[model samples]
Target chain A: MSEQGPAFDLSYVANLARLELSEEDVAMFEPQLQGILSYMEKLDAIDVSGIEPTAHANPVLNVTRPDEVCPSLPVEEALRNAPKSANDQFVVPKVVE
Target chain B: MSLASQTIKGLQTLLEKKEIQPKEIIDSVAEAAAVRDGAIGGYLGLDQELAHRDAEEISGGVLAGIPIGIKDLLNVKGQPCGCASKILSNYIAPYDATSIAKLRASGGIPFGRANMDEFAMGSSNENSSIKPVHNPWDLERIPGGSSGGSAAIVAADEAIAALGSDTGGSIRQPAAFCGCVGLKPTYGRVSRFGLTAFASSLDQIGPLTKTVEDAAILLGAISGGDKNDSTCLDESVPDYVADLQGDIKGMKLGMPKEFFGEGIDPAIRASVEEAAKQFESLGAEIVEVSLPHTEQAVAVYYIIATAEASANLARFDGVRYGYRAPDAENLGEQYAKSRAQGFGNEVKLRILLGTYVLSSGYYDAYYLRAQKLRTLIRQDFTSAFETVDAIIGPVSPIAPFKIGENASDPLAMYLADIYTISANLAGICGLSLPCGYMTPSDGQRELPIGLQILGAPFDEGKVLKLGHNFEQSTEWHQRRPSLG
Candidate 1:
């Protein structure tokens, strides 16, 4: 219930998300982060004792269609959309280098 | 040549009868756009050549040869889909959104791309990095957003109808503010394959049109299973147009007391009450209903939505696609600098809050709890539906506020979405239809107000039928903004 709950530590979350947070952003976000977490704590008091967890409100039925391969946009048309490309693959900065 | 005053249905009738050719309609629509769009700023981009070509190819449908605006968030192949952000300024869609494809199949001419809040983050269209879209009713005011341009374009008759995406009231709020009809179809009812995700769990592509029937026809054409979207349901897509006039003679309508309580404009309350009386005159029963957890909808919605948005937008790290900063020394700096420079203030705030909530210790306390509240909120609707066929309320607390009035305060912007966000969170169908207008005590001018109708999951027909019935009993939808 305290503002100092889980949302305060940005580094822990940044680690989980594989994001590296700057010191400036972490300092700036602390209070705003605390405000959101405290608001969420209000939900902790609600009772759901025998209620079944529903992932989707609408009834979930399998939406299976015949496994048929369909034609896709021609490679030229597809590649025409790439901002930067070499050969047939999208060109990106080398991560390993 | 004043096609600005004509409804989509009226224009369609003219085209079918050959009284006016598609080229003539496009010409008139173009002229209207030139005259009115400058004041309203509804369009982000207008493709006259593409529109003329599509107009020539129009064969038949309820929307035959109708010039329709597409929200910038929806992919329209070969067109810039900037999403009203400088970050995406150079991004052109490689393919059309599924709904856009359906519109083309039905002979809808894509006229232009409408402006929106950047990445669909804000309730006011002012969040758009491009020129702000003004309310056609009053140029000094805002058109409710992130679907503001779509609603304003239809309101100003710049286009016959526009495709809008509703994630937490984006379509309906703008429709309400701009004095038009907008429908948010049930989740997974329409394909979301090409939509730029804001909050995936809440997003549904819907229609912003001049009338309820147009909304229904548009919904019928777009709603169905798509192999590209796994969330799409396999349920049978009923002909919404065919079911438009079904009898709701004795159906029960729930009037939630909480929605009509304090903070709602008195004029809006009167307007909705009058609409309820009209529904009763049509033999429908008005039953008072309680959605006990209604007050908590906004609080729960923000937490869950931002969490989902954080996850969805994580892909835009300037790595695989989109704009990357050129001066970065390493990958880490590249992502940070790119996202920081690319995203707008509101977008950045949400991303920060989302990352905070979903972070290690916070995930259990904030994200998990919010998900559980979402269940309770859905349950409230489930139980309420047992007593009534539909629920009614004001689409927003007040008519469109003056432009720039709420831009500085983020909380004020979020408050405008209070009444409309719950339906999206609960994954149900809802519609906003013009009911009446708000005339201040000083009597300067009357601004429009809307009556929102919400129905059970996949009950769009019932929602549309009720909305159509209400429109039939009132002249609100027929009244156009005086832009001349």
Candidate 2:
């Protein structure tokens, strides 16, 4: 928490979130970044003794239905709603060179 | 009958008598939407053809042929689920959300999708990428968000009832602002399958209705076990409708001291106190209860919510489905450009905060500690329930602030959800119903204020009974937003 995260280098966050924040946004968000960090710092005051951490509030149990396959949306009907598609598959720009 | 005055039960009664056909109800609702929705911005999109078709198919159920609005965050098969964001502008859902399926099975007419904050992230509806939903009471004020549209539509009588999701006061706060009944069911009461995730652990699908009885009927229809969502409880969902008229006599009600303390607007505070008096008049015992951890609720909520949000939103990369930016040179750039171009400022802020807190080095000090505090907060409620059957508080510190009042300051906007979010975080059932109106000291207009009733885990019956008793004694819920 010590090292001042790069003034404009949210490239690390961008990499982690697969997001591309503009250089302008990174500059704007820099000052406010510390406020969020400080807000999280307030949690350090709470004392947790003999407390078991809970991930989900309800008791965990497997919710399974019978293994019967239900009919799916037809390919043509499903693809009809897609913005761009070809050969019954969603069309996308070429990725691999 | 005018669509505005017909409750879900009233409509069902008319339908049973064949005095009003389902088609007539659909047409009346469509007419109301056209007249009222333009001013309020309650709907993102409306499907007249599908709605009519659904109404025509209505045969028998509790809410048969009753038109309902789905929050844009929930999936409706083949409809554009914008989630009020530009990122998924053209994304159409391939499946109906589990709650929607339940509503359909129970004969609900899916009239339209309601607007919400982009991805259920903000308190005011201003965060919506598409359009801000205005309060029907005063067009200049907000209707509250991310469930703002759901609340507004129900308040304005554009829909008899609407389904909404609460991550952190998304349902209750908006319901309070719009002067309607909103319930955030016990976390696992409703399944989360196909409701677009904001904070998976905290989000619960519930209803916004004109009356507590309608809310009870809607919750009964939609809640139960779901195979698709593993987090949903397997326990039998009790007949909430049967318990709607339960005796409130001799029931113990706790009034949390912190909730009604300073910082609460005097007018709103008076409204809650008056509501407690009404409960006492109804023969329920009112006792002062203290939740010492009340001040830490907001900080604890942000940390835990953002951490879960960071993990849940990781699925929105430009991969399997949803928005993908065009003209990216590589896979990495594609993922980055798609999200960056797609998400709004608030959504990005949460994602960044979520990712930062959950990051490897800071995980223990930030995320882990927040999780530990969450347990303590839950225990605070559990211990208080030992002394009282239910806890009551002011739903929000103030009545609906003007639209742009807190938009600039994120902290001010976060504080608006202060009293309501803890119920979501603790995974308990809570409902907000109109208690009275308030006129601010600055000569600002009077708006509706709500009293929040929270019950023990899976104890919605107690909360509903208390709300029902209050509604029977007072005429607050009877007052409609002056849309004219």
Candidate 3:
């Protein structure tokens, strides 16, 4: 393992994932996250200079569906599970002042 | 024999012959679950009225009247789909997943909510926010997970068969631990429309059944083209049940040397090797092959899967359906507070690791490199398949451990998935069936060992045939666990 590995800023990473972690959570996860990152460093030794990266296992390209109209989930059914819904729309906290 | 103890095929025969009623079977299983599920913890919810209603209308179909367990990770329209996590604790699926719709159309009643590791994130069921599913073979040990409850219920006869999603051995490992047959189809073989995503690329829905034939039946029914999930292939799905009787004569089976090396339980290795010898006696050639990139599978899987997970789970903010923390100042606080409160430790850890790997500064070095390595892993299988019709190995390196044995140690828990992770990475199909059981020298309860058969993409017919032949030659699948 090299000292050049990312410092693994736990709080910064949590915020990136949209997770709010208490200090206790950060303390607990920091070392474990570092261990996993160092373990992942094993991939650097393999010379994959010319190998193509596979995003999906199947060879699917430009899968376009026809523009024909199809029945979709009804708005009421879709919003039925929303924690806060009114007027057939999901109500979210106001972002702007 | 107890009707509840019968396999899906066994019960189907009786149902078709009018010797036993679907209602009777459901009642017995529901009753048994009511009496025995405390020790097993298999079902998160069981709807008796719905089970009865589904049983009342059994007809002439492949899976008629067979009660199948639905893993909580799958959406069973109008049922709670918690994924065994607190985040979605109050969530109710408004529609059936493609597989569930198919199962219902086939007259296979989706009976109950089977438990799983939260968001299908853990190797053991312990990470479940609901409850830990116990191994039917030994209550103190884990039913290997995140498909733990699906395996446990089938093993305990609480359900004739069950549906489970495998992402890094969730289906196979638990099935092996619980002494049943489990299969993860080739990537895109089954539609993943309603399955909550843990890792979209690696996650696949599969069947956990009491017998290979039942697994074949369920797999065949639930698989095919679906417009909803673009990953599902448009290729024709073969009748897996009808194709299960083929002989393996002259077929080449590869035994990867990496699968048998150090860290594997000696007994488990010997058992899997013996299974290979059994294949030899069945006139199949067993060749020793090398998958050099095997060791890096777990490392690459964690990085890629978690990276995808971090992205996928971003949808579960407090705004839409699911659990939302109250008394938040605004949307941002709501998002963080809800996620932090809702997720379990394993989920949180993976999210953190995933976010780190995909974070702007580290994305190319970690995520891209892992994806490249993933290509190498897939090539290993593609090349190996060129020489052999199928590959054989142990499902897990060791038998099921005690409930909390690896709970505190994430790496050890991650290592439990080493043998099963490669197939997912390769986008190939694999099956796990009981090859043998090993009783420890210290006189602990005997544990089931699985023989994993791997086939090329869309080679489920070959895999199921091999499993059927192997099962016919041994008594391992016929053995039942006597649960308290």
Candidate 4:
């Protein structure tokens, strides 16, 4: 994060991003992030009042399928990418006690 | 030249006559890889058996028997879709991405996993955590990224052509640097279902090939409506190859003066100006147009792209699949550690920047403001197309630099995509083809510079026609890097 980021709370933002940074990463990235964020500040000068935000370049109508069960990835294949799996379910750290 | 170096049209003709078997094309590609990949480091993996299986199963698709390299991000069933990052290094794709399925249906065999910047993040291939792709033109210099491997290998003849995803200049910049033909189709022109998401709005899958005609063929194969990707407009895919004939007589080409302004390499600008004159000679009218919002393109792209990327990448949390940090006592620690350890530095920086912008009290200022600027950027194109049939410019401001030259300077690196990023923002088709060369004074050998042709949304046929005509007239696309 940038200096403003640290001032505004980079750890808070990192926690939001779910990325843990090492001391080296923070040290190396801080000045760089500061530079990038400062560059992004250039956007502030533009008067974009009343302009609509474009979420998609070519926005499509909400597509509705027939909702029929199409052939989906088999359970085994779906689980194939999991780092920890059993019984066709991903095993993960406990979410609840 | 080996068969692998031949254009798709050349190979397809021979295949039609039984002059060469499909497997032989795969064999040629394998041979090229053995000779060239060791030096270029363009491929992450190549399975001969898979290539042969694809070749054997060919059903006379349009690009029959041709082997096209697959960028690591796109899913090929049972193949690792690493996206050139360690996070998903162990993950094998469960099914073919729509583009791959369509390409396979066209009889183009997916040959190898080419390297890329981790999750298609950076301007140079140096961002690849797996291995950086070297520019085949000059072994020590960097191939532009995140489609660097796709472009490098196509230039090196390791694969007949390759699939590359362009979020912002991933395909075009690398194509310019490595001297290959790269096309970034209009956003939503090609489905994004199977390809790893970069920024949903800006992300698109296109081709990196040896010729503009080859790009046309591949673009034809992969583009169409997909049930899986809603944004893939129901707009019909045209016969891009058929549009290639006829001179560009009386066609209007716009040269945006903002892009040609100071800070671009004089040599590159001269080459493009020379190309504009060439286009004029070929009967196209070159007109000066202004995209006033051009200066804000890079800034807006970083904000909107990173904001979306922050959201898209949230799926990588160590849960259902992908790399999981070992020995996490809690889910929070797991998410943090997995991303920190799994991603490279640039990825982390972008995520942090994105997360910050989207964070409370800041979202309205940064992300929203950038989005509004994006609309103005798109309007610039809409207005430009009113007078010009297509826009022409240099792909990048400068030639390919040496490895580590801008590695430490992230902002400097981001600025390199200045010429290419707005096309993505505007959701238009853009093509990069060789126009001229930069002969270095130091005897380091000459490097290739590319001329970029951008067309209106779903106007790929027009751009392809323009690029193909130029390619047929000039000998630049014919020049290949000499392999020892």
Candidate 5:
């Protein structure tokens, strides 16, 4: 990191995002991402010693519903768009040894 | 005028008189789509059979017999809700979005899948993996997006009206580019239940139509409390149609100097200033105001929007739904490879940006700072609204640029949304309507210019009334592009 800004480490962020970028993708995105990050640095000029953060401006607060059991989407409908599903369950690759 | 190009109110009137049938309107839209869609590419797919089937049963509602173009992200049961991303290309919605249910309740048939930026990530439609939507005004120019197709379809008369969601100017910018009316209600004014999440804090679904009254009619149908979305306001929905008929005799409109000054093209600045004069002629007083923090809005938006987007978009992991990579040896490979292979360049980039901003150590620097600045932006609106009924400005700083001209520069593209993005940050209602035209020296066709109208939170009625008065005094709303 320098006075200009922290250098954007493409591989580190891509791994965090769970995206497998190839040489072509890296070549394409690196400079563009750098430019965007630098553009964001302009926000640092404003001094905010005691300002509160706003997640959103909508006035609504916490909402709740009754605890009654309700009918939900059928297994058949829920699994309809899955790439691989069988016996009302989604199939996936195993991660652990 | 052709039935396809007629306003929703115009068509509704004809249907009431028995001068035209419900099926005729659907057929007219289909005919228009057939003739122009090859050039416009606004729709990814149209459900003509389903639309016609619903048209048969259409009766006794404000939108009765009218077909509305559905942006691909909205879940309309049995229709493919692709979001213009390759990952969701094969996914069919199992249920209707709350807004779609309300539309159908009002007899509006959800007709087609309009293309958009994959996950609504970009300001230009070029980010769409399915296909880029072209502005109907000029074939080579880029249509503003991520709701580009929604605006283009309504402008080209392929559909009477369409629904669009705005995170940061997705709906209004495109509407300005394509010469249509786009209204983004205050956050939580409309439910986000079946609408795919982009940025939860800023996302809202609204209408793109040919006239201000048409926007009001469509807004009335989709608004109200929805139990499905907790953030959705339980407040009463006003009669926007009645509001449209009210006079705008002495309303004060704030014109922010930040929007009218440098960075905006001189020609666009002149057109917007001229539009301000027209507002005065219609008995409204224009007062100059300053939103000093306007410059930092775009910077804050990318951080906050992308941070939320990272969390929201992590659901597309190929385990439950959407495109999945085959032959992955392990779960890690499956997650990474499927996303890398299925998602487009822009979507991948935004996800990475979001992930970086929200990463452990950097969160305080990027995401937290943006939130505090967002408070400042919202306060700017709060102070401005105390003295004025609404704020007026330009939608985009320049005419729609050529395809690929600004796509490579993400910052440049994001800056184009400068005027429209602050309202989303502030969570206030904003509308973009055709104000004037720009006759470019490079092209023979005139480009449409839009003036943005901003109102206090949940104050859409006042915005509509002001737009309606300006619309009535001018002939801009009546101007249509000739596909020929």
Candidate 6:
């Protein structure tokens, strides 16, 4: 970690985000991201010790729907945009290997 | 005037009178768009045959035979809702978004696919993976984005009116840049059921139109409670068009000192202040109000919006829909490769920023603090509302800049959003209409300037009324760009 910058590793964060970035992306984005993070650091100066964080603008309660079944997308329509599908199921690489 | 250039109300009246058939209007618009949009690049595609057929069937609906442009972000059933990104280029919407359903029921023909910033991420349309949208007023300048194409198409008269999603000023800023009327309804005022999510908490879909009346009419058509979008308020939708009349007598308009201060371009500040004076003449009182937390809006927005964006966008993985990277060694590699290859630079940067802020170690320091600041920002508006009915300011700090000017500097682009992001953060409604034009230092040509009118949550009627009154007295909305 640098003395004046964030301690978080860029590559580590990118990996967690499931982003595959090249070395050039790393070199270019490191300082840029660092600058933005430092800019956001200004938030620390204002005293927010007592204020509760607002997760959303409106007050929302648990939204529930009736349990009765309704018409859903037909199998063909649901599978229309799938990159790889067979037998109306999305095909994926074997995870158990 | 050409059928394409007419406002929604004008076209609707014409269609109802049977003076012009819907097919003729679509054909005229299609021809004009083909010739002009080649330079403006406002549309991704146009389906005139379907539009013609749909138009012919409609008789006496509210928008009868009037064609409307759908932002590529909104799903119109059986159309390509690309969102102007390569990732979703081939993705066809299997069903209509609830907003589209309402529009169709009102006799609106969703005709053209307008371009946008990739996944609605950037302030300039330059971020579009397909092509950059040019401002109709000056082709050399950018149409402010992520609703760039929507605003540009409306200004150029390629679409009678268009729907745009505003998350951090995507709709209004672009409308301001392109010299049109753009409204962002309160967060829950309009259903977000069909619109692609950017910052789910802040995103709301609204209309970009040539006139305030057109905007009001379009807003009324699409807004109501929806069973699909739970966040959509169940409150009754007001008759915005009917509310457009009447004087602004005894109404107090607040001018936020922070928005009119040092960073604003002198010309834009003058134009907006002049519009305020016009409101004063119309029996409205102008009062100076302070939103002390205004300075913190952009920072708070970047954090919260991007955090929500990261979560909302995670659904675009390779398996179920959209693009999937070929030649991936494993599932993990596939997810990473597909996203990295599919998304544009701005989208990736935002996603990274979001992931970083929401990361374990930094959550309390960045995201949490930002949320706390968000509370303060909302309080500032809530407190100010007690003193004034609405707030007005410059829509953007500066006039439209040359395309590719700020594309390289992300921070500069983010700072431009300072004036417009607060309403979204506060969950209030805001409108931007052409107030005046400013000729640049080069003296080449004048660019349109927007005056932003803001109201409390669900106060869209007030905002539109004020805009309607101002627009009635000004020639700004009447001036059309001389597109070459």
Q: What DockQ does predicted model 2 obtain?
A: 0.50
lDDT string for model 2 (B64-133, tens) is: 8888889998888878898998878878888899999999899887778999999999988999999999
Q: What is each model's TM-score for chain A? A: 0.71, 0.72, 0.90, 0.85, 0.89, 0.90
How does each model score on lDDT? Answer: 0.82, 0.85, 0.90, 0.91, 0.91, 0.90
lDDT of 1 by residue, B1-484 (tens): 4665577778878877789877777777788888889999999988888778778787776578777789999998888888998778888888988888888888877778999999998888999988899988888888998899999999988888889999999999999999999999999899998999988888999999999998988888778988888887867888887888666799999999889887888889999999999999988999999888777777778887888888998877765557777777766777777787787767876887777677766676666666777788898898999999999988998778888887766655676677898898889999999999886554466688989999999999999999998898789998888887
- Alpha-carbon shift of residue B141 in model 6 (angstroms): 0.8
lDDT for residue B286 in candidate 3, whole number 0-100: 96
TM-score of each: 0.93, 0.95, 0.98, 0.98, 0.98, 0.98
Give the least accurate 10-residue stretch of model 5 chain A, judged by summed lDDT.
Answer: A1-10
Docking class of predicted structure 3: high
Give the winner by DockQ: 2 or 3: 3
For candidate 4, the per-residue lDDT at B293 reads: 97
- Model 4 misplacement above 4 A: A1-7, B440-443
* lDDT (tens digit, per residue) of candidate 6 on A19-89: 89999898878877877777777666799999989877886798778888889899999999999999989
- DockQ for model 6 equals 0.82
The list of candidate 5 runs beyond 4 A from truth reads A1-4
Task: Write down the RMSD of candidate 4 (Cα, Å).
Answer: 1.5
How do the residues A40-84 of candidate 3 rate in per-residue lDDT, one tens digit apiece? 787887998999998888878777788899888899999988999
Per-residue lDDT for A33-63 in model 2, tens only?
Answer: 6565665566666776666776666657655
> For model 5, how does the per-residue alpha-carbon lDDT over B250-322 read when each residue is reduced to its tens digit?
9999999899778887777888899899999988999999999999999999999989998898999899999
Error of 4 at B376 (Å): 0.3
Error of 6 at B461 (Å): 0.8
Best by the DockQ measure? 5
